[model samples]
Target chain A: MGDKTVLYDAHMKLNAKMAPFAGFEMPIQYTSIKEEVIAVRENVGVFDVSHMGEFFAEGPEAIKFIDNMMTNDFMGADLYKAVYSPLCRENGTVIDDFIAYKIGTERVLICVNASNIDKDYSWFESHVTEFDCQLSNHSSNYSLLAIQGPRSEEVLKQIEIYPTGDFPYYSAKEIQAHGEKLIIARTGYTGEDGFELFCSNQFITTLWDKLLNAGVIPCGLAARDVLRLEVGYPLYGHEIHDDVTPLDSALKWTVKFSKNNFIGKEALENYTPKYRLVKLSLDKGIPREGYPILNEEHETIGKVCSGTMSIISGKGIALCHVEKAKFPKDKKLFIQIRKNIVPANYHTKPFITGGHK
Target chain B: MSNVPENLFYTVDHEWIKIDGDIATIGITDFAQKALGDIVFVELPDVGESYSVNDTFGVVESIKSVSDLLIPVAGEVLERNDDLEDTPELCNESPFDNAWMLKIKMTNAEDKSSLLDATKYTAHCEASH
Candidate 1:
């Protein structure tokens, strides 16, 4: 058995296929991954993302402390805006990728991957020696729900959860619903216009009921994974990990060089990438993790990190890491399935586009 | 509960077989399809391939993972389900009928004795659950 989120009973009632993920027994799918993915793309869907980790960083030096911890430029971030960054080690390898909401200069709410909660907290504690900031792990205190799609705004509007003014993309707002404080952010992993609501665990069931009553379909982690992959968004353990540097994972854009100093900036500046992450569209067969990539002569080149059949494109797609020098030049590659070498072509990522806000 | 036709035979790996003298039609059971969740692709073997019991015949891929299709009886493939090449989801939609993966001429007539009958297979599925 694994840890259960606040929506465990709700998922069971919905007859979801539950599976263990990141030490939590979470819902993998309700109906089907393809159906839930299409619902999120064409209509609207909600995900119980309460298993993710949340942290509160506060103090007079919180802003400076966060800027030093993350790769992105958090110093110039506007209030209520969320900045996506990878927390890296001093050796320039990634610790985890996270989204930090700059609620205020003295206070920031960070969302990190569920599997890295303990490690990330320890890393944060070890690095706060000189800063006058306090960090608290509030992962157990909150339950999160993401309502995503083109019609997400309408569903939230039915419940009167909208703010008074324009709520820009990648921004968060604190509002009151059902006599409880709710932080709704226009952010998601599906590459669709959506809002993520963070509420206290005690009130999450009630909020879930309200969303369901408003005709919102409940999606699961499986659908979210396919949606993110279709958008070419990277998952932590799959696309980037503790052994992978930002340069190797195609995350160089997140690193801000103009900053005086950060955890991985110095090492990143001096180091060259050893591997290149490439996207491939297969002619046939689904490319799965750890599947070997081969050249035209059947020489093993690299391995697939993430892959699935794109429901939109109707083709198998994958993100794989190849040695920088061994990157296929002819755009021709082969993914070695059990007994067959399936041919593929190098393709630009974000297999489907134009769905973001 | 999954559908189990009263006349067909079942294997421990959840494959069903319908025998017509020496010729046998093979397909995965409805229980297997439900467990796999949306079947996106079915890798069928060649029509002329010979296989023994427990040999991996092909693969059935869902969005979650891939499952090996285990051959239940020793036989030489007589015909393959060419329709599944264009629409693998037929396995999920109609596993017993339209998704029949292969028709094989049995090499060992006594292999059917090892398979469970409908009543026994139903009990086996219940016991596993």
Candidate 2:
């Protein structure tokens, strides 16, 4: 058995299939993966992401510490604005990817992957020696619920204190709901207009119950994986890893070379990526992680990192890291599906776009 | 509760076989389908292929993972369920009826004796979970 979240009882009440993920007992599906995924894509769905870690950095040197630790520069970022970035090692290899929110002038809240909570906290502690800041890991003090989909605004409007229409993407605000303090951020892994609510464990349960009673769909990790993959979002262990750098993961846009001396800046400046991440659509068989991607000559060129049968596109889609020079210019590629070699086509990312506002 | 008809023969790997004379129709049990989540693709074995007992005959691809379909008994493939190639969700929607995977002519009719009945299979499923 793994650690159970505050919403464990709620999931059990819904008869959700519980599975161990990132050291937590998480719901893999409530009814079915297909139904849950469609609910997020077409209507609205809610996910329990309380297992994710939260760390707060505050003091006079908070911004300096964050700017030096992450690849994305937050020099002029407004208060309550969330910035997505990759935390890198000295060698430019990603330790983790996270969203850093500027809640105040001297305070920042970092939301990290569940599995990297301890490691990320330790990394921050080690790097804070040069700066005068206090870092606190408040992972256990909070529970997060993500309401995502085309109809997410309509669902959130029922409980949110502020007008849902005014919240911009990558923005966050502290608000009160049902007399409880909650932090609402217009950010999500799924390619949908959504808000992630962060609050105390007690308030989270109440919010979850309220959403459930309002006829909002309760989704699980299975649907979340499919939805993120459909939008070409990179997952931690799959697309980015301890040994994979931002350049290799198609996240070069997040790396601000103009920033004065950040961690991994020197290594990243000299390094060149050998493999490039590309989106693929299979003509027949469904591609899976670790499946060998072959070139036209049947030579192995790369391997799939994430894949799924897209519920919206009605085709097999995959994200693969292929040899930069060997990538087919004609968009033709082949993937080894069991015994047979299936034909595929390479296309630009966000395979199904225009969903997020 | 998973439906396990008393008339069907079961394998430890969660496959069900219904015998019609010397021919046996095989499909995954409702327990197996529910465990695999959503079935997205089914790769069927070619007709006329002969396989020994426990040989891998096909593959079932679900939204979460891929599972190999093993032959429960030694038999020669007589027919494949071509319908599943287009609509694989039938495996999840109706694992026993419309999603029947293969019909095989049994090589050894005596193999049926080793298969479990519905009650024993249900107990096995309960124990594993």
Give TM-scores of the second chain, every candidate.
0.97, 0.98
lDDT of 2 by residue, A276-329 (tens): 898999867799999999988999999999998887787899999898878777
CA lDDT of each prediction against the hidden true structure? 0.91, 0.90
The worst-scoring run of ten residues by lDDT in candidate 2 chain A lies at: A158-167
- What lDDT does candidate 2 reach at residue A331? 59
Give per-residue CA lDDT, model 1, range A236-298, as digits (tens). 999899898989988889999999999988899999898888888887889999999999989
lDDT of 1 by residue, B86-122 (tens): 8999999999999999999999999999999999999
lDDT of 2 at A188: 95
Off by over 4 Å in 2: A163-165
lDDT string, candidate 2, B16-124, tens digits:
9999999999999999998898899999989999999989999998888889999988999999999999999999899999999999999998989989999999999
Off by over 4 Å in 1: none
TM-score of chain A taken by itself, candidate 2? 0.97
**Model 2 local distance difference test score:** 0.90
Q: Report RMSD (Å) for each prediction in the order shown.
A: 1.1, 1.5
| Fraction of native contacts (fnat) of each candidate | 0.85, 0.92
DockQ of each model vs. true complex? 0.87, 0.86
